[model samples]
Target: MAVYTYTVDNANLAVQDLSTGESLTDIFTYTITDSDGDTATTTLTITIDGVNDGAQQGAMKSKSWSQA
Candidate 1:
């Protein structure tokens, strides 16, 4: 039996920007090695879909006013 090991050159992927009906593609390289010291490398392509996020808010304060 041959034991195989897999490795990825880059595993840290950034999140895609928010858009309407848009997607992003990211490419990376990976390698597979066997117990016989043979290695196979190839490029992998991944697609990231766009999503909608809720609005961001900041801190709020209260003030008092008087009228004469």
Candidate 2:
């Protein structure tokens, strides 16, 4: 049997959303190694959707809402 662990860091991620006419990129990478001296690596990309609220907060907000 083998063991694996993963970690993430987003200190440099953009604070804007894609729906606000802005786009951001987040890259993820992982590596695995076995006791038999075998190693493998992989990468993944992710994109988040922005809210369409009618108000602008000068930056990306964690929450948003509208009144009818």
Candidate 3:
């Protein structure tokens, strides 16, 4: 089991926790909002190392990947 961390970006929203059947120890959930008033949700799945971060240790994982 691993840890999944991420932050929702938009305008203003609430934080939540969700389990998408991914094999992980800890999981973080956030809400996405739209200042312009958009009625849709943007799913940000935090992965191990996204954006090719040099020091991904302190980076957010917002991506989706098939469990192995």
Candidate 4:
């Protein structure tokens, strides 16, 4: 297993390569406090999907394709 951390601007969010072997979901919380004793909070969700990345080595037994 591995862990990755990222820093982003306040209006930008992005994630990639999250469908590898170790698919998992995580929640991150951020809090900001202003000088006038005001505060704001934000929540972000990180989700990783499980997908087979390896290719078939043998002859093609069957195949199918689709688009949505």
For each candidate, what TM-score against the reference? 0.48, 0.42, 0.20, 0.39
Clashing pairs in 4: none
Clashing pairs in 3: 45-62, 45-63, 46-61, 46-62, 46-63, 47-61
Candidate 3 per-residue lDDT, tens place, 8-41, comes to: 5423221122224332232445455567876454
Reference-based lDDT, residue 31, model 1: 86
Minimum summed lDDT over a 10-residue window in model 1 is located at 7-16
Candidate 1 TM-score, C-alpha based: 0.48
Clashing pairs in 1: none
For model 4, residues 1-68, the per-residue Cα lDDT tens digits are 32558553323222233345655566889777878999889887876555554666783588789999
User: What C-alpha lDDT values do all the predictions have?
Assistant: 0.62, 0.60, 0.41, 0.60
| Ten contiguous residues minimizing lDDT sum, candidate 2 | 8-17
Instruction: Give the per-residue lDDT digits (tens) of candidate 2, residues 6-63.
Output: 3333343444323665655567787888889899999877655454657667756588
For all the candidates, what are their Cα RMSDs to the real structure?
8.5, 10.0, 18.2, 12.8
* Clashes per candidate, residues 3 or more apart or on different chains: 0, 0, 6, 0
lDDT of 3: 0.41
Model 4 is weakest, by summed lDDT over 10 consecutive residues, at 8-17
- The most accurate candidate by lDDT is 1
Q: Write the per-residue lDDT of candidate 1 for residues 1-68, one digit (tens) a residue.
A: 53544443333343434465676677878788888999999987876666565554653467899999
TM-score for predicted model 2 compared with the true structure: 0.42
The prediction achieving the highest TM-score against the true structure is: 1
Candidate 1 vs candidate 3: the lDDT winner is 1
